[model samples]
Target: MSATTDASRGKLIIPVLGRLYSSLHDAGETVLRVVAGAFLTIHGSQKISNPFGAAEMVEGLGFYPGALWSLVLACTEFFGGIFIAIGLLTRPAAFAGLFVLLVTVWFHWVTMSQGFSGAEKSLLWAAILLFFVIRGGNRHSVDARIGKAF
Candidate 1:
């Protein structure tokens, strides 16, 4: 039988599992949001003090107009992360974060040739952002309060 079902009775087991899942659902999302947002915020804040600081490195990577891309990365990492941490415009923020993480994953794995060792952290962060993009901020989020989300 499926884990969600009782084999002997052939019935859905609603009480125990359902209650447990509901109990942890919001709390789990909150934890993911806080951790991801906090780290992204720190990384982004560092970039904000000098938005174009990465221009040389990015240009070296062949992302021409490096200054523009650098600023975009800085804003996406900082403001988007803050919006996510506060549970405001969460999906959009997560989407942006995930996009950035994907690029980092490629950079670490392919560009830097650091293999999984370098890419692992970014890959994990990408997974976290992917979850938020799909699941969205929970009921505790401002999106719920405002009654809209992207």
Candidate 2:
């Protein structure tokens, strides 16, 4: 009937729900970090094998010194992914990843005219990176261990 009646029956619904929610929230962030980090690392592996392989693509995107941009892209995705995975400089890494994903979003949307079909995954990844940019990898990260995150 009332809150007290429920407590007397040994059922504290609010406290139970609160604890469950907190646990799930923390665990969910860990899972998100792992998935985003591992996947990005894997995706970058091909380009990393030949850092300049994407030069033509970068040139086509109108970035000067195609080789340089290509190298930047390769390292950002590969190393940034690792940083994000370890929660080391998580915000910066996620921000860089966000930049890369945003470029892909624009490329897919405007250059290719593929819209959601081509950009959906990149958009999702960008959103996740954006989250990390704001949250800084949470308490489960290296940022937390070494010091309080910025």
Candidate 3:
């Protein structure tokens, strides 16, 4: 359709897909948020259970006070994931997660010398967290229910 026609339909370029998107975009975003948060939580569960299991690894990465940094990392992943999943304090939680993802990106790209191939996943995760850090949560989130965000 012409640009004017599409615009009149409340779509910019593609009215058919745009209408579909308008209907389900929020649900898609919610699913993305929940799934990403759940994956992060799962990734941290083992570390959180042990609490300091990553001490040596963190120390190797030059995070002084290995045990402390390990615990912090664990909490940042585990609890931050929970918060993000529930949409409670989403921006802060996502910001924390973004930091962790950025560290992983650095580790994979620089520390391991793995380059883009190895760092790609971390980069993607970082991007996702960065989105939440900027966008906070949606209407389906706890933040919305409680009438607060950030």
Candidate 4:
């Protein structure tokens, strides 16, 4: 091919690669959202189903009014996870997950002084949540569907 043709081909390739990368990123975000939502939902179910256990953990964490915080966290996890799964209010749900992870890191993980060990999972999830906040959900999301209908 001529030099000009080669350069034109290269330019076309860039956009194709960009589109592929964007699609992959969106798929990964969707997976992350679903997995994180499911995990949080299960954990929250445990807490809400057994309030005493949650209260004890809250007390151990030295949160004032342990029962209240436990209840709030439980609700946040349960409802937030559902919202995230459906991609309804995705930004808010992601933010809620990020907030929960921040609190978990500050209250539970920081005390150990062992960086990214026990808290690594939460930190990873927090990063994923932040990503969702920035990118929003995929086209499969309720938000996108609703947006198109209006």
Candidate 5:
């Protein structure tokens, strides 16, 4: 049998809960997307205010033209997060966020030699952005309302 059938049939021990879950599946995804974007936005807010404050840090991470990269990172996290949260140009925004997160992953894992323990949060954020990069947004998004996605 198909996975959906298996889930809706044999696998569900509580039929009522299963039915509720089925109905709210899209809602769950929306919640995840919004929360992820919001958290990213919050994380960048201070950096965005300072703009080039991360220049030295990014240079330490081996990003040349530290000022430029720092500005890019700030804008991507701030503006990109807003875009992703509203599902406007979600894929592109998520792609940008994913790029920044990958850098953080490298910084935490390899640069700091902290391994997966330190890189865990960046890795998780990267995965979530990757999902938005692949899936764009769902029906509840502005992309859906405007009938456009990029």
Candidate 6:
């Protein structure tokens, strides 16, 4: 091929590659959202069913208003997970999860000698949620399908 043709082909390749990368990112985000939502839901369920235990655990860690905060966290995780799973109000749900994670990191993490510890998991989830908020749910999501229908 001529140099001009070769250069044009190379330019096309970049756009194609970018599109492929974007598709892969969307797929990955969907999978991550589903998995994380399920996991957080289950964890929240455990706390909801045993609020006293959750409160006690928080109290043990010396958190003020332990019971209230425990309940708030539990509800946020549970409902936010559900919203994320269905891709309904995904951005808001993600924001909620991110907020919870930020508080957990600030209040619970800074004092611990272990530094990150278990809070790392929540922090990671928070990052994922923020990504979802920015990128949005994929075509496979309820939001995509239902949103268009309405």
**All models: lDDT?**
0.86, 0.89, 0.90, 0.75, 0.90, 0.73
lDDT of each residue in 36-150, candidate 2, tens digit only: 9988999999999999999999999999899999999999999999989888899999999999999999999989999999999999999999999998988889998998676
3 or 6: which has the higher lDDT? Answer: 3
Off by over 4 Å in 1: 1-18
Candidate 6, residues 55-134: lDDT per residue as tens digits? 77667556668888788778878888887877777777778888877766765577554468847876787788888788
Tens digit per residue, CA lDDT, model 5, 14-131: 7667666767788999999999889889998989999999999999988889999999999999989888888889999999999999989988899899999999999999999999
Instruction: State the displacement of the C-alpha of residue 54, model 2, in Å, after optimal TM-score superposition.
Output: 0.5
lDDT of 4 by residue, 44-100 (tens): 787667654577777777776878878878877888888778788888887887888
lDDT of 2 at 111: 97
Instruction: Output the worst ten-in-a-row residue range by lDDT, candidate 5.
Output: 1-10
The better candidate by lDDT, 1 or 2, is 2
Q: What TM-score fits each model?
A: 0.85, 0.87, 0.90, 0.73, 0.92, 0.69
Q: How close to the true structure is residue 118 of candidate 2, measured as C-alpha lDDT? A: 94
Backbone Cα, N, C clashes tallied per candidate: 0, 0, 0, 0, 0, 0
Superposed by TM-score, candidate 5 places the C-alpha of residue 148 at a distance from the truth, in angstroms, of 0.8
lDDT measured at residue 146 in model 3 versus the true structure, 0 to 100: 98
Model 1 is weakest, by summed lDDT over 10 consecutive residues, at 1-10
TM-score-superior candidate, 1 or 3: 3
Which residue window of length 10 is worst by lDDT in model 6? 1-10
lDDT for each residue of candidate 3 in 38-111, tens digit (9 for 90 to 100) = 99999999989999999999999999899999999999999999899989999999999999899999999999
Best-to-worst order by lDDT is 5, 3, 2, 1, 4, 6
